[model samples]
Target: MAQPTTSLLCTGLSFEWPDGRPVLDGFHLAVGPGRTGLIGLNGAGKSTLLRLLAGELTPTSGAVKAAGEIGYLPQGLTLDTGLRVDEALGVRAAREALHAIESGSTDQRHFDAVGDDWDVEERARALLDRLGLHRLGLDRTTGELSGGEAVLLRLATLLLRRPDVLLLDEPTNNLDRAARERLYETVAGWGGVMVIVSHDRELLQHVDQIAELRDGQVTWYGGNFTEYERTVAAQQETAERLLRNAESDVQRQKRDLAEARMRLDRSASYGRKRSVTRNDPHIVAGKLKRQGQETAGRLQGMHTERLEEAKRKLTAAEEAVRDDAEIRIDLPRTAVPAGRTVLSLDKVRLPHGITADLELRGPERIALVGRNGAGKSTLLRTIAGELAPLRGEVVVPVPLRHLPQRLDLLDDKLTVVGNVKLFAPGAGDNAVRARLARFLFRGGRADQPAGTLSGGERFRATLAALLLADPPPQLLLLDEPTNNLDLASVRQLTQALAAYQGALIVASHDVPFLRGLGVTRWLELDGELRAVDPM
Candidate 1:
C-alpha cells in the first residue's frame, strides 16, 4: 500500500503575544512526510509554531496550509477529570452508536456517528494498552489517572484520529522508561509528517531531520540531533575563525591609519621648511598645503572605512556563535560527610500502598524510575515528609528540601525574592538578592511576581528558594525537574545540580539526564523500591 503524502507549510508567518511581545516574525517553513525535531532555547517560539500549525492559535500575518488533517498534543496537558476514558479517546459517541445499532436501532444518526469505525472501542483500548494504560478501562474517569497517564491518554486520542500531520510538544515529559520506548516506537513507525518539540536527546535521535528555531526563524539541518550538533560545532569553529581574522584586519587597519597620519604630519612639516627656505609665493605655498591636506584626508578616510567594515564583519561573526549562558553556583554548606546518613526509610508505605526500604549516606545520587502512577512521586513526598507513610517511618538525619514536579512550592502572589525570604527568613534583603542573582534572577528580575515568570524562570526561582533555605539542605529530592524546561534550561539545571555536594534523589524519566548526574544508585518504584541497573 502507498503511504499518504503529507505536507505542512507556513509562509510569512508572524505571531505576537497578547501583550505585543513578538515571538515569530516573518518565519517560513515547509515540512514534508518524515519526523522533524524542533529544538531551540526556551522562549524561541517552538511551541508557538506548533500551536499555529495545529490551528489552536492564529498567526498574526500569515497562513498555515496542510495537505490533510492535523493533530496536536500540547505540553502540560490537563484533561477534564469528569471525562471518561472513551470520551477522552474521542470514541464515546461512536462506541455508543455501534452498541445502539447492534441492539437493532436503525436510526440513521447512529449509523452516521458510527461511520466506518465499527471497532472504535477495541482500537481505543488497544492503543491505550500500547501506551501502557492496560489497567485503565473505557469507563474509568480521567480523575483516576496520573498526570503522565493523562498525557499518554491524550496521545492515544490523537493516534486514533490518524491525522496526516502530527505535532507533539514534550510528549515524553512525564513518561517512564517503558512508556518512552512505546512512544519512540510510535514515532519510528509513523509514515505521516510529524513535528516534535522536545529536549529529550533519545527522542531527538529518532528524527529524520532537525529544524532549529532561533531569533524568529527556522533553520533546517539535514539529519538528527547528533548530526545537528556536529554541524553546529563546525559552524561555531568557522565563525570563531572569521572573527579572529576580522579582528586582525581591524588592528592592521588601525595601525596603518596611525602611520599615515604620522607621515602626513612629517610631509607638512617638511613642506613648510622648504617653503620658508625657498621663500616661495604665498599663493603657491597655500595651494600646495591645500593639496597635501586633501590627500591626507583621503588616506585617513580609506583606512577608517576599512577598519569600520572589519568591525561590522566581526560583529556578524560573533552573532553566529551562540552565547548560551551557564548557571554556576557553589553550595559548600550542602555537603555531607561520608558516614552521615542522609535518609532512611524503614518499610515505609505510601498512601497508594507502595512500600520502600532505603538508606543513603554521604553525597550519594539516586534516580527514581517508574511508570506513571506507579507511586514515584508519592515515594518522594513520603521521604520529604509532605505525606505520611501508612505503615513505617522515614528518618531524615539532615536538613532536606523537595522540588515538586509542578513547582507548586512557590507562592504565586509573592515576588521571587519574597518567596526566597519566606524560605530564608534570617537572610538579609541584600543577601537574598545576591543569591537570587546566582540563580539567574538578577536585580529587578528577583522582584517579579512568581506567577508572571516563565516556566524556566519559575523553576529557577523555586530552586533558589529551596537551596537558600536557612539551614542548607544536605539531601535534595527533585521530582521530574525537567518537565516543562527547554534544552537550555535543562542544561542549566544539570549544571546547577552538578555543583551541589549534597545527596540527591531525583525521580524522573529522563535517562540521558540521569546518566549525566553521576547517579550512584538506580531505584525503580512499582510496588516497592529496590536497586536496579541503569538500563
Candidate 2:
C-alpha cells in the first residue's frame, strides 16, 4: 500500500547562541518526498538543523513547517535499562494507541476496530532472522548485546513505525557488512521521505540529493555523492581560473598606476606652471595641480577596485580550501616486519561452540566473514587478548593492535594527538603536534578532543600511532575498518595496506577492500576457528 506523503519547508531559519553568536541565518530548506543525504564537517549544525526540522527544538527566528508526522532516530539510541531488544524501542506508546482503538476508546463503536497487529512481532522476527539476528534472543535484555547489535535493534524498531517521514542520524555507524547491507536494503525499499546524516560515501550513493551544511548555511546538490564530488571539483576549477585572472588584472593595474604616477610627476617637474603660453603662470600651475589631483583620484580608484577584487578572489579560494577534504596522513615507518604467526586456533569452536584448529601467518590478508553475531568480532577479540579461548591457545609472536569494531581503546574525551601520545612516550610536544598534522590534525585540530574526531580521523590517528610505535608492531587486527569512512579514505587505507609489510588479520564485510588487499586466507567465524576455501 502507498504510504502517506509529508512535505517540509523552512524559511529564514536563523539561530544564535546565548552569547549572540549567530549559528544560522536566513537558512532555508524545501524538503519533499525522497531520500536526501545531510553532511558536513564536525559542528556544521547538521544535527541541530535536524532537530529543528523534527520539531524537537524551535528556531530562534524564522519558521519550520511540516505537513505530517515525522519519525526520527536520534544520533544515539540510549535504551531503557534492562529493556529487551523488541521492547527497548518503547513502542508501547503506539501499541497502546492501537489497543485503545481496539477497545473502542478511539470512537471505534462508530467505525471498524483496529485489526490484530499481533503479527507485528512475527514480522519483526522474520526481519531479524533474515539479518542473522537471533529471534529467541530478542527477549533477552538488550544490554547484553554488543554496540553493533544495539544499533541494529534500534533501527529495526524505527522501521516498525512506518512513519510518513524518517530521519536517521549515522544509521549505519556500528553495523557490520551484512547488517549494513540489510539496513540499506530496508531504506531503499522504504516508502517514505528520509533525511540522513552520514559520512559513508558508499551509502550516500543512493541518495536522491546531497545536502551539505557548511559555514552556517545549507547547500543542496542534485545526484549522488560521486556527482557531488564531481560538481565540487568543477567549482574549484572555476574558482581557480577566476582567481588567476583577477590576480593578473591586479598586477597590470599596479604597473599602470606606477607608470601613471611617474608620468604625472615628470610633467609637474618639467612645467611647474602650465606651458608658459604667455598666460598667468600661477593659473597654469593651478591647472597642473588640478590635473595631478585628477590623475591621483583615478589611480586611487583603480587601486581600490583592484584591492576589492583581490579580496573577493582570495575569499573564494580560502572558502574552497576550507570546504575541501584536506586529509594528509604521515604513517610512521615500521621498524619490525609484520611477523609470521598472525593467527592460531586449536580446536576453536564457533556458534554453539563447535570447532577446529587453524594457524596463520604473514603474506596472508585473511578475512573472517560471517553474519552478524556469528563470532567474527569475537574471534578477532580473542586474537587481540580481549577474549580468552575456551579450550584452545592463541599465541602472538609480535606486537599487535586490534581496531575494535567499537573502538573501545579510543578515549572519547582526549584529542587525537593526546591519544597518540598515550601510545608513544618521550615524543616531544612539538613532535606530537607534528605527528598529528601528518594525519590531517594540523592547527586547532591538534587541540580537539579525540572524542570529537570523525570515525575516519580516529582510525587514521590510530593507524599513525601504530606506525610510530618503537619497533612498530608486526601484526594488525582490524574489525570492519571501513565502516564509517568516506570512499576516498577507504581507497587510501586500502592502498596503504597493500603496501604494508606487516601481517594483517582483518574481519571486514567489505569484500572489495579484502579482494583489493590480496587477502588469500579465509576464516569464517561461525563459532570456532575453521579454515575455509582460500580466497
Candidate 3:
C-alpha cells in the first residue's frame, strides 16, 4: 500500500501515570494525511495517546514527530466561562487591533499585532457558521452556551487554525443531531492528516481507515469502521478455527503417546517371554530389556513434546480472539405485564416550558430524539421524580430508575458494594456482591471505590446499583447513556438493556443504538412532545 505524503510518527513512545500505571510501552505509529479513526476499549490508551500527540502529556521515553502544526480537541474541554467567542477563537486581540487601525489610530503597534491576518475575525465566524454556531455572537461568553455549543465552539477554533494535523477526542459526545451532522460535514471536507478517537459509529464511518489501539499496540485496517469490523470478524473466525484445530492436534498427540506407551509395554513383556523360552544369557536378556525401555522413552518424549507445542499454539491463538463479556441477568421483578400502564405524563410542562403528555404501556421501548436543549433530559428527569414539572403531573405506576447522562448517581467515596447496598439496603453483603458480579463487578472489583474507576467502570457500577435497587425498577429512563463510552462498553450496555423487561425511554442522538433496542415509539421533542415514525 502507498503511504500518504504527510506523516505523523511516534517511535518507541512510553508513558506512565503518576500512580505508576503504565498505559503505553514502546508504542509506535505512523499516521499520514487522511482521516483515521482510532478505537479501542475504554482503558486501551486511546485518550492518552491523543494527549501525547497533542503535547498535553509527555512520554516517558521516545518522541513524536509531525511534519507541520498539530491541533487537538480533547474529550473534555474546560474553557474559561468568561472568555468571549472571539477570545476562544484566539482572534480577539487581532480583531481589536485591526479595528483600532481602521478607525484612524496611527498606532504602528496595531499593525504589528494585526499582522497579515486582519481578517481573522471573519475567518473565525466562518468557521463557527460551518459548525452550526452562526447565531452565536463573537462577544458572547462561553458560560452562555450550552454544553454542545461549547464543544462546537472549540472545534470551530481548531478549524480556523487549519493545522496540518488535527486530533479530536469524543467530539460528538454532547452534540445533538444537527451539530453532529455539521461535524460530519466538516470531517468530510478535511484534507490534512486527521485522527479522531471516538466510538460514535456514524462519525467513524467518515474515516479513511481505522487504527485499533489494544494491548499498547496499534493495528491498522484499511477503509472505514464498517470495513474494519468486517475484517476483524473474519480474522476472529480464522483464529477460532485455528484454535480448534490446535486443540484437536493436542488431543491426538496425547492419545498417540498413550497408545505408544501401551504397545511398548506389551512388546517388552513378549520380548522377556521369548528370551526366557530361548534360554538366552541373563546379561543378554537384561541388555535387550534396557534397550527396549530406552527406545519407548524416546518415542514417548517426542509425542509429549509435540503435545506441549500444540498446547502453546492453542494458547497463542486464543490470545488473538477478544472475549468481551456480556451482561446477562434475569430481572424477573423488573418485568411489567403487557396490559399494565407503566407511566403517564398528563400535560407535563417541563421547567423550560416544553409540555409533554404521554403514556407508556407494558415493556415499551421509546427513543427520544431532539436538538440540544430541547428538554428531553428535563422531561426524563420529571418522569423519574428527580425534577418537578412546571405544570401537570407525571404518573409512574411502578418503581422507576433514571441513569442520567453524567452518571453521577453514585457516591464517589463509597465502594461499589457500598453504593449497591445503599440502594438495596435489605440485601446482605454476599447477595449484593453476587448481584453486582452479574454486572461485571466481580469479587474485588465490587470493593473498588467509585472515584478510582474509569469512565466505563463507573458507568457499570452506577448501573448495577440502580438495577439492583429494592423492588427492581420496572421503568428505566436513560439519558445519552452511551456518551463517552468505548465500543465495548456500549455493547455491554446494550446487552444489559436487552435483558431489561420493562418500560424504557432513552434520550440519545445515537440512532443506531436506539434502533438496536427495537424502540416501539419515537418521540421528537423540540418545544413539545410529538410522536414520530421510528425511522
Error of 2 at 225 (Å): 3.7
Best by lDDT: 1
Q: Report residue 158 deviation for candidate 3 (angstroms).
A: 1.1
Q: Give lDDT per model, in order.
A: 0.88, 0.70, 0.87
| Alpha-carbon RMSD of each model | 2.9, 5.6, 2.9
Question: What lDDT is reached at residue 320 by model 3?
Answer: 84
Most accurate candidate by TM-score: 3
Cα lDDT of candidate 1 equals: 0.88
User: Model 1, 26: alpha-carbon shift in Å?
Assistant: 3.4
lDDT measured at residue 371 in model 3 versus the true structure, 0 to 100:
83
Ranking by lDDT: 1, 3, 2
* TM-score for all models, in order of appearance: 0.90, 0.75, 0.91
Q: Using alpha carbons, what is the TM-score of model 1?
A: 0.90
Residue lDDT tens for model 3, 321-343: 88977666678888899999999
lDDT of 1 at 346: 90
What is the overall TM-score of model 3 with all chains considered together?
0.91
